[model samples]
Target: RGGPTACEFSFVLETLGSKIAAHEGEYADSDCYEILSELALLGRYELRALKLELRLAIEGVRADKFELPYRIASERTGCGFLILPVTREFHDRAFNALQSLSLASKHELELERQVGIGMWKNSEFVDVEWIFLEGGNPPDPDLEGRLAFSYPFRRVSEQRLPPIFT
Candidate 1:
């Protein structure tokens, strides 16, 4: 009751693979599809079967699992359209992580990247937007954006920033 229902989870699992494949077509040939398909397989199983299946899949992909920098972006930042600043250090780590997972090639990791930000409320990601960052500065989410979200810039010192996925 606190999280997504089984039906909702099933729908997300069913659609997530196709959505990722369509948006990030380069990852289509990688182990990403197999990982996603493993997740999708959970939808076909009952609760008891789902647990066993998920455990097996987790074991299979344990070596490849990498953390996203969402926690770094979220901490101390309140609810709003955040101008999340991604440091060069974070960027490099992210690239290496993706490379390890075979999800990105050197050429595919551009100098400028469009980061997908999810807005969470009441334990759910209510809205998502792709914001482009160039030279570590994100475009004005309010001016160049059409979303109804508010903009609040939370500035953190580089020295205070923790090493990502450590």
Candidate 2:
């Protein structure tokens, strides 16, 4: 259940303090206008819901500090929700789940053709720029892990298993 657009405008606002704090002198530039326009477009209901949830989670974390265990969230009530926070022993299991999810979201393409796959944190199909991809990352390994598929899906015959003599 999502609108065509979503924003965490209030998150920015909360961190920024008053609205005027965002619009003071040189700060009130085109970027600020864009932010304000974005904020204006938000559904107040959605903002309230997200803010409430974030505040509770933030409060809980603040109470426990950063050492607060990682969580698997369950149903939420007006007061709070059930969360299965990760323990040190099960941290590896949680890590595996997160790593797998990250790997699932990313992709890599070259020359309008895919050269690799990307695993990102978000479940979204985003258009990425070539320059951005080129800037970082070590070479993709030639083994199974995060799957990589180059463009046009080459025929099986294109790759040789090994030389016949070998």
Give the best candidate by lDDT: 1
- Across residues 1-166, which tens digit of lDDT does each residue of candidate 2 receive? 2432223323334433444465676465343344334334434443444344444433433343322212111111111111112233434454443333222222221111111111111122211111001122234564224445432121212121232232
Question: Candidate 1 lDDT, tens digit per residue, 1-166?
Answer: 2343454335434444555667684544443354343333322222333333333322322333322322112122211111122233343343333332221111122222222222112122211112323233234444434222432222322223343342
Instruction: Assess every candidate by TM-score.
Output: 0.23, 0.28
CA lDDT scores, all candidates in order: 0.29, 0.29
TM-score, cand. 2: 0.28
Runs of candidate 2 exceeding 4 Å displacement: 1-14, 17-23, 27-32, 64-166
- For all predictions, the C-alpha RMSD in Å is 16.6, 18.6
Off by over 4 Å in 1: 1-4, 24-29, 40-166
**Which run of 10 residues does model 2 get worst, by summed lDDT?**
125-134
* Model 1 alpha-carbon miss at residue 164, Å: 41
